[model samples]
Target: MSRIILHAGMHKTGTSSIQAMLNSNRDSLRNNDWEYVFLPKDAKAAYGYIHSSPDSCTYSEAKKELEGIISGSDCKNFIFSSEDMTAALQSEDLWVSKGERVSQLFESLGNIEVLIYYRRQDSFYESAFQQRAKEGVPLNFKETLKRLPIMSSMDWYSKFKFFESCFSDSKFTYISYEKAYGGIGITGSFLKYASLNDIIPIDHSKSDNASSKILTKIFAEYGPILDPHDQSLLSDVLCEYERAGDFRRYRLLSLEDRLSVFENYYQSNRNLYSICENADVVDLDIWRADLLNEYSNDYRNAVDDKDIIIDLLKLISATQK
Candidate 1:
């Protein structure tokens, strides 16, 4: 049976890691009879086609393109991933309510599996806020957490529920973001479940990119705080970076600020975990401590030979190229 796997990210839960892995190893994945459809190369092309024609990009039209791609490919397993899907959850309108767009998409697939990876709320929220900060929109942890509803206006649970309502629970598998450490294990699980293990070789070297939290904090604090006009400019630059496959450095919060932020995240995640008992929530403090230890010991030890600032410049160059 043909299978469709949808890896809908909850954001900041190593979604980029997964996307990078898929992109860097597309050929191998395809050889294993599994096709990963990224936007523009896959679904994004359909989204663009729909946006351009307006009328031609209807749910039916988009579904036809997706079906054609899947059917024409030799792969029996299809994988689609996008963090944008998370926005669908917080939407006021259900997937069905948004015309027949979602329904058509689902109907086009033979066997569909929805995959989600959620982090403890605090960690997810803090990381998300820090991301916004790097974009020059600084919001303290408390304020950012307060805006969770607005951030997730699409009703986070609704997106998954939409699929669940249409498909069985067996068709959905939610993993913990914590399990995504080092990237290989998560990809292995995905391959195993997709039954493409025979085709796709698990390459650990491909998962070499690292987002320096230290650099991220610096950018968050010092990057130009963008207003409307500035934001547009920054967005353009970031888009270019994305196209060039270069990762940007994020600003960091001060030591005091970092601790404050962590505290807020800890409290908030504890509450969220209490309410969402079904979620596989990992403790943020534990993860944070582990990262700290790794950075202080392993990362520093490895890079001790080079000047930290010079190394950062090298990273920037490598990413841009």
Candidate 2:
């Protein structure tokens, strides 16, 4: 019997890193007897289908692409990874009912397993806010953080009951971004399920790209520090910056500030975390601490020297390359 694994992302959870590694090591994965089907421009294809279909939330075009992949390949195991799936769930109204869509999609596949990763609400909201700013959304961190409910509403488990209803406990797994690297046993368990085993080398290269809380604060306060003409170029480079887990310069809110923010979303955030805990999702305490540590370290090591600006400029230039 064939196996189909669908890795639907909850976003801000190292999705890009995983996707990049998979795409970069496709040959190795194939040699290990696994067939990987990655849409060259998965986001474009996903958005194309989403925007084009006014009546359906399901990306029929993307689904068609999946159909072609399944039909064209004879591999017994197939993997489909995309963070957009989580977005789709969040905007459930845009798609047909969740139950209907899941049933229809799964009917076309063999035995299927669903995987997702969850991040802490506070951390995800902060990072997502920075990301929105980079994308031309003129939202400051405060405004972005204030919109947590709207954002968290889109997470897969939060919006779609179909995923839980359709798949057994054993068929679904949730991982935390905190345990994402090294010879981590958590990652080992995840890979074991995919049957990738030890055939693939662990990716030790730290993510150079990923939103830095400090950098985000800097941009928020000073406006685009990079050359305006290079905004587009810098945006490209910063795309991966979110994965770097580099949080040097970002200061955590004071106890009062943290309490205030938590109070604002007390019920909602609690419920969200509760759902994750119930679903066996790994907690993100470790990751949150790591982010804070990086932020503090960056702030301390930050220099007001011209060399720092020069380095930033160089990073922008590299993005254009």
Candidate 3:
């Protein structure tokens, strides 16, 4: 029986880069005695989503699907990476909790190892908002926050218990995603985790998982701030930014607000650290983090135009079916 390694995602904690690296280096990884299973990017077939569902049948279905994947593979080491798998690991669903999903789905597989990355809850959701924006959600920072499921309520203790139930705590390679705490980039850091460092060295700059120039450009100019009242103007800016990749000073969030986010999730995170030995919940007291906008003051000096507002009610009368 070959060993199985799973990378369950704490979304927005650099899972994309890790998955991209594993995908691009699949052939090389196989040469090194590891095979990374490819799953559909989205929807029901996506085991990540199914494994976390409260529906019991989904687990059995996932188990069947997984067995099919493994039966076809000849490699001794198999890798399954999905951020969706841990979506609500801390929450208990009526039918099945996320941890129980893992337990039921892989109960027959025997021994397994898991790799997970933990990020400050506030910081994780902040990055997550930007990701949705890139996908054309047309929502500002705060709007996205309201639309997202409650993240601050997530219980890390339950999450840690969930993974440990499926795969023993000792088999997890938990990494904290704080730079000062030795949070290196995925490709740069995970080779040693997978024991593939001796066989293949990676140049992450070329990894498929890296963020796009349009996004990087936007991040450099503005942080996450957007004008919701100026929908037309904001839309125009959004379109042009994607097409032209322009640079400007944008507001990501306020220092006070960011701190509040840290404070809000602080106790819950501490609870996680107390239960899980594999992860080091960040020490926010001394940990300094980055903001999206560097020139927040510059934007404050600018004025807004009230006349530019376009009333959709008025536009409704201007058009006819």
Candidate 4:
């Protein structure tokens, strides 16, 4: 009857850092009566069955798969983390059924706690697009936005209600990515929330999750032409610049556009706040102010080819040293 904690990352909410931190401290965490289950093979397939198609697999079979995966773990508690779970929940045709399946899949494990971190709608939209762009999706930012399933993804209230209803007997914790993660940083905030006091020093300098705005732009414009090898080199060059603090801010959304994102999801956000007892009107207002200030100056700022060439030369010279 060990407790089960699931970190269901609603993407672009610092999930990578959190996962990296957990893995780095896995042994220490295990020593402290908690086990972090790494899922990329067998467990991922098992999770996908429950997350994508509810009626595809029986609850008993799913439970057996999970139990088998963690067979040797002697920890008092278990943690499963995956951001892809949020993608399944964002599918318009599958969210509700998936939610029910997810609940049922874990029903055998007593005292299940589902933890989710949600970013602001506007920020979430932009971040998600940027992620696709970084992966060399050749579409421009605006076109990318056109293809996102915004209604299903941004309707936080509806999703929250579905999750609450499905997990009626379990605990569901919803956290605001912007408002909730204070100065302690996302990884620190997560550990705090999970009630873990282990002080595992993470070297943020080498974090792989930090995306380069310059790299995103280059990929968006030239991804189709560049082969895998070229793309990898380009990424390395861009990342070098990013690490040296020489990259410029890239914002494809205008101030007006970002504001409109919030406006479009305004009512849903309010309704979401109604259910979340810790949410406050002041937090909403502050979030708006932060968004406005952050996006006011950067809108479709083009990267200069000459500057990139110069930086590329600089990188090559340094490498030759």
Candidate 5:
């Protein structure tokens, strides 16, 4: 019997953590009849076996390698994960490119089960901004989003719907990150999702924590503003920093602004979960109420008036166009 579990992530949803667990616990999981299968060394690392830039020759070779692993192993369960599959965007038509990746993947792997986690819109935007900063986009939350419309679109329902059309046969299980946190936590929830809670131990000792590298990307992006010597020295200092850090994690968008974005996805999210439009899975209403009660007009955030001014200028420039 052969079984495949594809954990395609919707960025910023603890994907690196889940992939780390799979990489570290491979042997232990193999003992439990579960295998974290391999693709090309680069593909396994950067993207789930699905390549970012797809080619038939590369995917074909990978398919051969994967089939060999499946043939030799007695394990009934296999996992391959890379959430950036649907998350990352380079152009307006991400679906065509990513959808091609999925099509190539299905052609290679044959019948397989796919699992994806859908994160709420507002939280996804905040966390994704941090990720973009890692890739050396130093703009603030609002600006980065303005540049990346696919991200700002917050169109999870349409993306997932496309996935359904692409891999319609595979068993689909949707995990709510908010719901998962309130219950068995991330790793625990994954094990439960895989039905391996009793089989494989949830060990995260060696999980990859890539957050530390954000400073390097940020400094690199600011290279034009720094001298060569200063840039090198800054890199050294950033690497040794005692703690993980990102752009000051302050409120980037106003609550009213965030709510407006959330409204775009309200019906989409409800459609995904088969819940009523008024029901909140992302807890926006609850989070909004609590935040409003905690902070007053006197509460100042780290976002500077200058940054707000820049945002306004950008908006003004856009409207004129």
Candidate 6:
């Protein structure tokens, strides 16, 4: 029977890089008997079906659209990826039914490999928030704390259990963001998972631009005042100032708060370790050690007042020019 590799990403875990690699190597993957499946219509329609209500007309339309993609594919084996599927895990009210609906979409494929790459809850929260902050949204530290549980609640066991309950024949494989993202990086890690590393040469040159925590804090604090065009210009300037790494890292949560957040999901994480394939891959020890040692020191809680004023003036001057 042909197989399906469903890379249902827990977002902010290098999902884009993996998808880019698949798109870049489409011909090679096709030659290897594995086709990367992309929904012909709105790419997000696949995720829309998962969140759409069964009572609504959208649910049926989305289901039919998704099913069409699978049935229409010329290749018997496929690799489908969508990070937005992770959003269902956060919806306690809908995850089970959503999982069931999704399982039906893939029932024709006899063998299913559910691939997930997860980061520690605290780091995941910060990284997710930074993405929003960069989009000119105001950041609230207290609100960030309140949102911590939502992140922690997305524990490995619960997510895998959702799949197990929904798809009886599916096999689960979970990898930590730290481990999978090593010298070879997440794209390479995924290639290794598909057993294509040796045959598929990896291009190590592509990488995400360096993001400065200092600029992130500035965006969070001053985003609303800037016009959309100015914000776009500032974003370009940020990329040019990638060397701003010398500045103190902007932190939303203190070491104490971050540890508290991690501990909230500690037991559930440990429980997952027991049942997870190659439990050693989820290295909580190294993660905790880095938190307590390398990241324990107090860091800038906000962008420096002087620096912020200077940066804003510079932005204004550049935009006015």
TM per model? Answer: 0.61, 0.66, 0.69, 0.79, 0.70, 0.80
lDDT of 1 by residue, 1-321 (tens): 777787767677667767887888788877777788774456754554423444347565677788888889988887888765554455455434431344346555777777777664435555676677556564544455557663543233444455566555336776656555444566665656566666666554544222434433434433455455544444444444444543433323333455555555554444444334445435766756865665456433232312534544455456557
Highest lDDT model number: 4
Indicate the worst ten consecutive residues by lDDT in candidate 6.
Answer: 38-47
- Superposition TM-score, candidate 3 onto the true structure: 0.69
Model 4 ranges with Cα > 4 A deviation: 39-45, 51-58, 69-71, 150-152, 180-182, 199-211, 218-240, 278-306, 309-321
Name the regions of candidate 3 deviating beyond 4 angstroms: 41-62, 150-152, 166-170, 180-183, 206-251, 275-321
lDDT of each: 0.56, 0.57, 0.58, 0.70, 0.60, 0.69
> Which is the winner by TM-score between candidate 5 and candidate 6?
6
Model 5's TM-score against the true structure: 0.70
> lDDT for model 1, on a 0 to 1 scale?
0.56
In terms of lDDT, model 6 sits at: 0.69
**Which tens-of-lDDT digit does each residue in 142-258 have in candidate 4?**
667777665335788887777778888888888778765554677876787788845465332433433365566666666556677666666667666667765556655667787
lDDT, residue 259, model 2: 46
lDDT of 5 by residue, 1-321 (tens): 467887877666777777777788888898887878533453442244454544334656655656666677787767877665665443337666666666565544545777777677776766666555544443555556677665756666666667777776677777777666556667777988788877766543433333333343344345346555544444444444415432332454567777777777776776765522222455657766765775555344433335533543454455446
lDDT of 6 by residue, 1-321 (tens): 778888888788998888878888888887777788653224345555666744433655666665666667667678888776666787666677778867876666548888888887777777877777666565564565566445536577777777777878788788888666655788888888888786587655644432456666566556656777777766666555555544555666667888787777787777777666544333567767877776645444434658645875787687778
Give candidate 2's root-mean-square deviation (CA, Å).
Answer: 6.5
Off by over 4 Å in 5: 38-62, 87-94, 100-104, 107-111, 134-137, 202-249, 275-291, 294-321
Q: Give one digit per residue, the lDDT tens place, for model 3 in 1-321.
A: 668877776677777777888888888887877888644452244355355435424545667777767776667778778776676553556214556666566556645777787776666665666666555445556555556674535555566665676555337666776541243456666676777777668454532312233343233233335444434344444454356433333335556667777677667767775555655555765543433343353664232322222332234234322
Best by TM-score: 6
Backbone clash pairs for candidate 5 read 9-83
